[model samples]
Target: MRDRIDEEITFRKLEVLLAFMETGNLSKAAEALNVSTVSVHRALHSLEQGVRCALFRHEGRNLKSTEAAQMLADVAQEVLALMSDGIRATRDAAGYSSDRLRIGSLYSLTINTVPGIVVDLKVRRPALQVELALGSNAELLDKLKQGTVDAALMAVPETEPEVDALPLFEDDIFFAAPANSPYAKLEAVDLRDCRDETFVSLGEGFVTYHGFVEAFRVADFTPNVTMKVGDIFSLMNLVSGGVGYTLLPGRVRGVFGDKVQFIPLRPQYLMRQTIGVSFLRARERDPNLLALMAVCRLRTRSVG
Candidate 1:
C-alpha cells in the first residue's frame, strides 16, 4: 500500500495532465510547459499507468482527453492552489517575506516623513506591498510590541530594551495659534506668558502631550487645556479655526499653510522630539526592516 501510494499520480504528472487538458494537444501542452512534445507524451503516459486508466486516446496525429482526465484536471487546479497558499502561510509564520510589510506611524509623520520613506522603500523593493497604520505615538508603540505592526515611525521611546531604534531626525515642538492671533507676530513666545491662554491639546499617551506637560511644568504652571484631541491634524484644525492654541512639531509647519502659525518657544521651555523607526530587536535582520533603516539613514543625511 505504501509503495502504491508513493507510485500514485505525482504533482508533476498532474501538472502535465492539466496542461494537456488546457491546451488540448500534445504539442501545445509541451509549448505551455516549456518541454519537448516527447516529454509531454511520456508524462501523460506515465500518469495513465499510475492511475491504471486510459486518460487519453490517439485520434490519428491528435489526442483527446477522456472524461476521467477532465475530472483530474479540475482537482489538479485546486491542489495546486492549496499548495501555493500553504507555502505562503509557512513563509509568513517563519518571518520570511510574505511580500507585505506592515508599517505604523504617528498621524503627523504622514505629512512628510512616512511618505518619503515609503517611496524609497518601494524603489528598493518594487514588489513589496506596504500597509500603513496611523495612530498616536503610544498607540503605534503598542502595535509594534504586540507584533500587529512590523515597524513604527514615531518619537523613539526612552527605554525599550527589546526594541531597536533607528533615529531619523529631531523635531522641535512649537507654539501653534491661529494665523490671525496676536501670538503669530512674535519671533518667539515664552510659555509663561501664555499662562492665561486657553489651549487645546492632544490627549495623554501622545509624545507631544508629554512634551506639552513638561514645557508647562518648566513654566511653573499647568496649562489651562480646555479640550483634548486624539490626533494632531484635528488639533491643528482647532487651532486654525480659533478654537484654542496648541503645540505642534516643526515637521508640520507647511501642512496648514497660512491658516496657522508656529512660533518658537523660549529657550527655557524648548523641547525636541527624536523621531525614528522602531522594530523588535529580534527582527533586526529582517530585510524589510533593514531596508527601512537604510532609507531613514539616507533621510537623516539629506536633512543634515
Candidate 2:
C-alpha cells in the first residue's frame, strides 16, 4: 500500500482539474468554481507534481490536457460519485431520512405560521415529502423525544437537556371573550376583577394552559374554569358562542375575527409565549433538520 504521507492528490484538486477540463480555460475554470485563476493554476500545477507526470502542455497561451489527464479525469469522476453515494448511505443508516421529513406542530399554528414554514421548506426542498402532526405542546415534545417526529414547532420548553430549541417569535397572551360581552368594551381586562366569571381553558399539557395557570397564579387567585377543551379551535368556539371567557395567544386574533374579541391583559397578569422549533440535539446535524432550522432562522428575521 502507498504510504499515508505520500497521498497528495486530494478530492479538491481533482475537482479543480475536472473544472479546468470541462471549461478548457484557466479563467473559465476559476469562474465555474468561484475561485481565483491563480488558485486554480496552483492547484493544477500541484496535482501534476503529486502525480509526477506531465498532465498538461502549453499550446500558444493556453494549457492543453494530455491523454493521461483524460484517463485520470474519468477515474476521478467515478471515485467522487461513489464517495457521494457512500456518504448518503451512511447518513441514512444513521437515521437521517433524506426523502421524507416528519414535523410536529400546534393546532393553533395551522392558521398562518405552520403553513408559511411548510411552504418555504417545500420551496427549498421540492422533492421532500413533509408530514405534519398537530397536537399540544406536551404531545409534540413527547413525539420529538420518542423520535416519531424529526422536529417540533411549538412553545419552546424551559428545561430540556436533550433538545435544541430555536425561538422564532414571541406572542403575548390575551383575554378572549365573546364579541358582544361587556368585557370586550374595556381597554384591558384584569384577572382579579374577573374572578367571578366562568372560563373555558385548554386542558393540561398545552403551553397555553400552563400560561393560563401561571397568569392567574400571579394574580393571587385561581380562575373559575368550568370546562377544559383539548384544542384551541374548540375553546375559541366556546368563547364565541358565549360559553365563557378564555386566554389566547395574540397569533389567533384573526382566526375568529368578529366572533371573538381578544383584549390585552392588565400588566400584572401579563404573559408572553415564546414560539419556536425544537429537535433532538443528536439529530441537529441531520440534513432535513438543518434545512428546517435554516427556514426557521429566515422566518425569525422576517418576523422580527
Candidate 3:
C-alpha cells in the first residue's frame, strides 16, 4: 500500500516540504497549511518513497532534512512563488484592468483628427487612458470587428451592416499645390483640369489616395501619375518639392501649414466623405466603451 501510495505523491508534496524547510520547522508550516500538518506529514511519507529516498531523518520531535531536500529547496521555492505571481496576473487582467480606450484609425486621421479627440477625452476622463493604432481603412475596420480595438475613426462604406456608424464630419478631396504655385491660383479645379498635368498618387490601401484615384476615374480621366508613394507624409513632401501635383483630403492643409494650398474641388466631382466612429454594437453597454463613444460623439458635434 505504501509503495502504491508513493506512486501517487506529486510535485505538490515536494513544494510543501520546501516551504516547511524555509521556515526551519514544522510548527510554522502548520500555520500556512490549506489542510493540516498531519496531512503534510502523510503526504511527505508517501513522497519520500516516490523519490526512493529519505528527505529527513527524524530525531525525537525534530526532523533534520537531507541533501535532496536541500537541493530542491530553491527550485521549488521559485516554482511556487511564480505560481502565486501567475494567479495575481490573471486576476489583474480579468477585472479592474487598466482603464484605457484603444482607438484605431486610418492613416488620414492618426495625426490631426484623432489627436484632437484624444485631447478632449483626456479633459473629460483624466484618469482614462488612450491608445492608438493606425492602419489602412480596411485593416482598421477589421480590427474594430475583432474586439481588439474599441473604435475606429474612418470613412468606411456607408452600407457596412456589421458596424454602427456615428457620422462625425465631412471633408472634400481637392487638388493640392505648393504655396505660391500656379495651381494654387485656381479657385475651382476639376479632375480634367489636371488631365494634362502630372499627378502624384499615393500608394494603394490609403483611404484618401484610393478615394482621389477612384474619383478621377469617375470624371473620365486616368491621371498622368509621375510619382507614386506609400505614405501621406512622403507624398506631401513630393508635392511640396514640385515633384508632381496631388488630389488629396482638404485636412492635409492642416499638416503642411502654409506649405500647401487645397483648392476647391470642382465639376462638383465631390468625394465629400463623412468620417465617423465605428464600433460593435454588442459591446455598446460596456461602461468604459460608453465613455469613449460619448467623447467621440461630443467632439464630432463640436467640429460640426
Q: Give, for candidate 1, the lowest lDDT window spanning 10 residues.
A: 1-10
Write down the TM-score of every candidate.
0.70, 0.71, 0.64
Error of 2 at 55 (Å): 32
Whole-model alpha-carbon lDDT for candidate 1: 0.89
Candidate 2 on 85-178: residue-level lDDT in tens?
9988987765586788989999988899899999999999999999999999999999999988889999999889999899988999999999
Q: Which pairs in model 2 have colliding backbones? A: none
For residues 1-304, could you state the per-residue lDDT of candidate 3 as single tens digits?
5545445456688677876887767766766766687877776677677777888888999877888878756666787788878866764453223478778887777777888888977888889888888776777888887767878888855677778867888878887888787767777876776778877877776778777777887879788888887777788888888888887787666688878778887766778777888877765655666776788778767766
The candidate with the higher TM-score, 2 or 3, is: 2
Clash count list over all predictions: 0, 0, 0
Specify the highest-TM-score model's number. 2
Task: Evaluate residue 294 in candidate 3 and report its C-alpha lDDT on the 0 to 100 scale.
Answer: 85
Clashing pairs in 1: none
